[model samples]
Target: MTMRSTMLLLAPAVLGVAAPALAQTAPTILPDATVLEVSAEGRTTRVPDVATIRAGVVTQGQTAAAALSENATRMTRVLAALKQAGVAQRDIRTASVALSPQYRYAENQPPAVTGYQASNSVSIRFRDVAKSGAILDALVAQGANQIDGPSLSLDQPDAALDEARANAVKIARARAELYAKAAGLSVARIVTISENGANDGSNPQPPIYAMARAMKASESTPIAAGETQVSVSVSVRFLLK
Candidate 1:
């Protein structure tokens, strides 16, 4: 074949390959689109089913050994009373124990050691709410010098969580519908859904001093556990039809 004829044939093939490369180099812009982000919260309230109390003995003596011995004697009586009151062995546990030196500080001199202090604390779980007051009174009479806590809680939280989750979904759907209607668009299917699990508020706090005094003086502590609320939140994205 002649050189001019061969050059012509090669030129067409090169141009064919370059055409696609040119198209790839060109920038393409996407059409405008709208996305709606909505957040919904749900809450469920329920009465607590269980209670926990921390009670113990604190003793002070000239030496650590003597202080610990005195604390042990009182703690033993307290534990025995708890067991007699129908508290299971597994439900009772030593939460803390410590021995520290008591300090006596003079106006300008270095602090001096006055005595040794020993403290032993036990945590008791009460499944029966009706008997919680009686149990506390028994511990006090048996020698529990330092008593704190009866943090109430729910034994089984699964049901409450389920209710919260369902409510969250309902709230999200309603919000999406509201936005869609306001913008003059028909309600469409959910494009995406994300959930944040239940956030039950802060840990239970012990009763206030006034309530505690009333409880202490009454024949039986007027035990009342108000409802606790569990809440859940969710974020949802919906596609416009």
Candidate 2:
């Protein structure tokens, strides 16, 4: 084939590939479109449905074996009381078990071993927050000496987060339209959407501090499941014309 024929044959193939490349690189936004990016946050509050608490027994004795034995006995009773109170076995998880020596410090002398302290703790989840206080009293009655926390939260947060996300988008669009109107322009369309983050803004209650002998026998500990806030932030790009 002549050189001129070879050149003609390759020209169409080169043009075909170049055409698509140009199309891919072409600007998506119209020349008259003005880009406006707005960030907005939306929040909603709901009552917490779950409560988590830590309950434990602490005992001291002259020997590690004695201390551990006493702690085990008390913890057994505590677990039984939780069962009697209708707490599910899956909700009762052992948090910790430890035995440590108690030391007596002396001036200019080696620290003397005084006694051994044994502790056993379990984390309990209460589906019914209203009954948690009464159950706590029962646990104490069964020899749970150390109690901490009734941290409240939502069991399922996906629906609440979705609601917040919708609100954020609404706010962003409203704000963008306001900006457009202020500039004597009308909103053309949304260019893009990006989510910044989501957070659970729960107003946590103060941890409950209870001892076996602190409260009166007739009064059950009171629990209040305060409302928790769910928030979502979004960035939206709108075109104005």
Candidate 3:
């Protein structure tokens, strides 16, 4: 074909491709709309039914083997005491074990290894919160040197969380209704629902200084457990009519 006729045939095909490209590159214009965001919080309180304590043995010796041996012996006694106190074997678990060199630092000098320290920790779950204090004291007498936490919790946290969730939904609906009335709009339907988080508000009780205190040869340690709280938060979007 002649060059002029070939060029004429190609022009329409090129224009067809360019038209779609231009349409795709075009910016879209959106209509004006208002967005409303709201947050709701809810809380539920319950007397804690269970308690967890973290206790351990720490031993230091001139050699790693000696330190570890001493720690193991003490931990054995602690475990035995826990079992005797009615703590189930399944509820008691070894959380951590470590043997590390202890260093003694001197002014303007490289530190020297002074001794070896061995630590073994066990986490104990007490189903009966009332007996938590006594359990702690018993463990201390049995040779637990390091006591970290008694983080109070619930055995069945799901129930409490559900109650809190229901309360949260109620709170959100109330707030949304109030806002809708103020804006002269009616509730249409729920657009979205989301959970921010849920938690058992069991604060870690202060570490008991039971290990440091000198106990009478025959005295039993006294312990106390306070109440625990559970909380939940949710975000819901309701379409306005």
Candidate 4:
């Protein structure tokens, strides 16, 4: 090849390799500006609107078949009472069903099978917090011997969490502005924003376990639906000039 033609071909190849390096060198942020990172948290509270409870029947008999049969009879009545109380079928779910042999222990002898115990339980969700207590009482009267929990939670938490997130950003920006002012500068712009921890607070509290008994006509179970807190934390980086 001629010397001029060789030089021309080499120039294009050199330009191709240099183009990507020039693109990569472009600055993402102002090189002369000071970078400040700040973190802040925000929280909001709302009253719980949903409650979860478990109701079950426990029976003991000489044989497993008898124990299960007796448990089924009582459980059927419990389910019926729940339905009559306006509980939706979708809100009711079988939690557990167990059949185990009872054992007797002697000082010098091995354990002996004494009887059989059978249990059946269902988890129930109450959309109306105020009316759940009355419904719970009816469940006990309908033969629910083992009753557990009224775990309180919010039915919807997305709106509350969004509110908290906005508050977090506001707080983070305020903090960055304060720092910039102390350093004799002003905040130019936000360089980066990242969420640290976002909590919806929909998780239920520890449940209350109780053995329910028949109550008088004027008495009913008491359930308190307290406030739940939704919180968010954010880390923000600001460029100061």
In terms of TM-score, the best-performing candidate is: 4
Q: Any idea what lDDT model 2 has?
A: 0.78
Superposition error at 60 for model 2 (Å): 1.3
Candidate order by lDDT, highest to lowest? 2, 4, 3, 1
lDDT of each model, Cα atoms only?
0.68, 0.78, 0.69, 0.76
For TM-score, candidate 3 versus 4, the one ahead is: 4
Per candidate, the number of residue pairs that clash is 0, 0, 1, 0
lDDT of 4 at 24: 39
Per-residue lDDT for 1-241 in model 1, tens only?
0000000000111111111221133122123434455667777777877777788888899999999999999889999999999999989989999999999999989999999999898888888877887888777778887776667778887777668767876776777677667777755565455664455532477543221232346585545666777777765555544
Better of 1 and 4 by TM-score: 4
For residue 219, model 4's alpha carbon misses the true position, in angstroms, by: 2.0
Off by over 4 Å in 4: 1-27, 30-33
For candidate 3, lDDT tens digit of each residue in 1-241? 0000000010111111111121133222122222233456667777777777788898999999999998889899999999899899999988899999999999999999999999999888888877777777788788987776667777778887878877776777777776777777765555445677778667677775435346565645444565677777676655555
C-alpha positional error of residue 100 in candidate 2 after TM-score superposition, expressed in Å: 1.8
Task: Give the poorly placed runs of model 2, Cα more than 4 Å off.
Answer: 1-33, 201-203, 214-216
Better of 1 and 2 by lDDT: 2
Q: Candidate 1: which pairs clash?
A: none
TM per model? 0.79, 0.81, 0.78, 0.82
* Regions of candidate 3 where Cα sits further than 4 Å from its true position: 1-36, 107-109, 206-210, 217-222
